[model samples]
Target: MAKTACDHDVLIVGAGISGIGMAAHLEMMCPGRDYAILEARENLGGTWDLFRYPGIRSDSDMHTLGFVFEPWRHEKSIADGPSILEYLNRIVDERGIRQKISLGTKVVSANWHSDRACWELVVDKGGSRQTITANWLYLGTGYYDYDDPYDAGFDFSAFQGQVVHPQFWPDDLDYTGKNVVVVGSGATAVTLVPSMADKAASVTMLQRTPTWMFSRPAKDALANFLRRILPEETAYKITRWKNVFMQDKSFKTARNKPEKVKQFLHKKIQKALGDHYDPASFTPPYDPWDQRLCLVPDNDLFEAMKRGKAQVVTAHIDSFDATGVKLKDGRHLPADIIVTATGLRLAVAGKITVSQDGTPVDFAQRFYYKGCMFSNLPNLAVVFGYLNASWTLRADINSEYVCKVLNHMDAVGANVAMPYLADDHGLEEEDLFDFSSGYIQRGKHLMPKSATTLPWRLNQDYRVDKKALAEAPIDDGIMRFDHVDQRTQQQLEAAE
Candidate 1:
């Protein structure tokens, strides 16, 4: 026997940045459409609250990362974790979004009933289980797994003073005056190295290969200037466009002129580190933006390296020793603590098992529709941000697009909207995410494929997606709309 909870027009999974933004959009646009947010954690703030590692901050500027409706009034564009969390919480409280949130409720699976034109979700709250139904399901659960970090299968029991992954940093463990060897050269390691440097006796970033890193000011001068002269919303819009255009241009330049971009990056790094910079230690084998660029605000990492508090070592780890990690080159780096900032273990749709009409829905076999929803998946939208730009930029567009979709369905007296790839659509399957990052590569098989053309491909460009998803025709022939009769709804429930 199962208990039934009240149904909602929309059910948002995850109360992170994306979920919060989605709720606000629904409240303002969808008026009477009732919705609820289900967060697995006890509290909200999602990633910002979950990641409590030292020196955690946004890689992108807050101008573009902040919600379009809410301007980030902070001095620092690349904000720290606590400030970001505060911003998220403030939005929830000010908008009364907490009333719609069901905390500590983990949705296990979502099964769609075609006849009923609704979804049946099995959720676990505390020790009891209940069934929740919704007309639309929005997934804001981020791509990575919160519990597990990709450790590269290293055995740490032999010689570990304290092994930690930034994803699951111990609350009480202290690294003061400790000799720490931070593994990997990604954003996390770079952030951890500089942050731990002030306290640690020495911090060494050990990487199999070097990554491209460049510096910018911790504060946004243009955003500040605009705020002082213009109205709050006006300044925010201007700053947001300024950053978005710059980021898109930079990414295009890197893609088109890889050699020039590489040289420019190398020169920038050389200037930052002065004569002490080693080409081999700081230079990446791939071109700029081959993987997402690591951000070093105010040249903090370079300054730390120049100050002799931290260093970068490019070497492959052979194995773990009783005292430290042994390099394949026969060099040993001694450490009192090891932080594996290797990568993340990716999970799709929060690892939920999806079944359509009693058959399992393999996301790998499906194509992404507008990078938000999947083909054949009705009334479902998964929020995945842009790879080349700020995450929220794309998320903002997605929320608005979903609102348009919901409104269109309601206006037509349609109960559901299903996307399908037609045989004549003329689309070649490509990986949804084009990034060469380790986490993406590891989880590529689990993700949905995309077409080569519009409406089917995941347009990572915010401008393109905004026009296609938000402004394009809602009845684009790809999404089929239909109404379910009372008898059909009854039969669908009986089949369950």
Candidate 2:
């Protein structure tokens, strides 16, 4: 048997927000630890590079979305995609992390060798197979599938003018002065309808159900004001904390006082749309936060509607005709172009086949530990951000926690650390995500379960997780640590 060389101290998959942030955290926290990032795409920006549809931008404000080590100085907190990509590039360039990233490399599978105390990865790098090993595996391979999006199951005949999915948007496709129909009620659909309205003859948002929508200023005046008086770091920190606090408070209020939050959000929408607002087209069936609320900076979507350049239609998509979508209510929307702003297909751990000592590690069967690591999983951490807030908010903390875990393991001379879930943990199983988004519902079975108690429970609250991941003792009894026995280590060394 050929020996596989151990490549680095840590191997991070997917060079997106999470991967980049994790690398930076390790550099800062564990100065001498060696790590390399493997990115499937050729570009550095993961989601930002993958998505190129019109008006692609962050739904969450950049203050919280931005990395903790880096301050977002851009005036528009709700920034466009290119700006985000540039920001990510800047981080990589400045930190000298770009040299460590291996592009066009896709991880196929990871096999953990207990005796070796390391993970051997099979990878496809530009069509050639290769192997690399690492003591610790970190997955930043976010939750979305780049190859396929959620198909809404609409049957369309060959009369198509132009059919597109936002995930695979075409560069040369022209919609100028042509009727456009955007399907879905999520953030993508909301962002597209208004953006396409600027040039398209008419833009219509078609949805089977409504999503809660809110509008805020594109620029953060308070953040700018603070920058004028306070130091840059101080101002950014204050604004970031403020946004985090507000988000946490609002989410709690929505969960506890659904009716109140519903009314408050609805009134904002009604006021924006004015007399043109049809409550049925904007009001969601479930309470606020049941699904993520669609945010439009400066009431762009509502403004487009008011200006008669765009409109919202609430009805079921019966099927797609050659020209456009046909409604179940027998309404026909004529369009020269159709944009399926449909949701993403969720793929956990970049769809990599993971196993421990010949036993397959099924994520669905395991429980989430601190929403970052999995129960009974050793020497691995998965960075899955908040479903409710800015993804980076969770990503930042996950990086910090991983660093702490590594430091603790090193101090104790432990080669392996795993979150041990006892049989008698006595925690009730709950759905991985409480959100009512269709995409999540379709793939909920593939997601790992969360417990109802502390440590095991996802919590999903930033404030709570901040302490749990950051301040909590790393040597907590739940996480077991051990080193490979001397005889086994000798055997592995001899084999090598």
lDDT of 1 by residue, 256-322 (tens): 9998988888888999999779999878888888899999999999999999999999999998877
Candidate 2 lDDT, 1-496, residue by residue in tens: 0122356779999899999999999989989888899999999889999989999999999999999889999999999999999999999999889999999999999988888778989999989999998989999999978888898776667447788999898999899999998988899999999988999999999988999888899999999999999999999999999999999998889999999988888899889989898999988889889999899899999999999999999998777778887788999999898888878888888899999997888999888888788998888988788988999998999899988888888888887889998877778987668888888898888888798876877778888889777667988998998886646577877899
lDDT scores of the candidates, listed in order: 0.88, 0.89
What number of backbone clashes does candidate 2 have, counting pairs of residues 3 or more apart or in separate chains? 0
Model 1 residue runs over 4 Å out of place are 1-6, 423-426, 491-496
Clashing pairs in 2: none
Q: What TM-score against the true fold does each predicted structure earn?
A: 0.96, 0.96
Alpha carbon deviation, residue 9, candidate 1 (Å): 0.5
lDDT of 1: 0.88
lDDT winner: 2
Output the TM-score of candidate 1.
Answer: 0.96
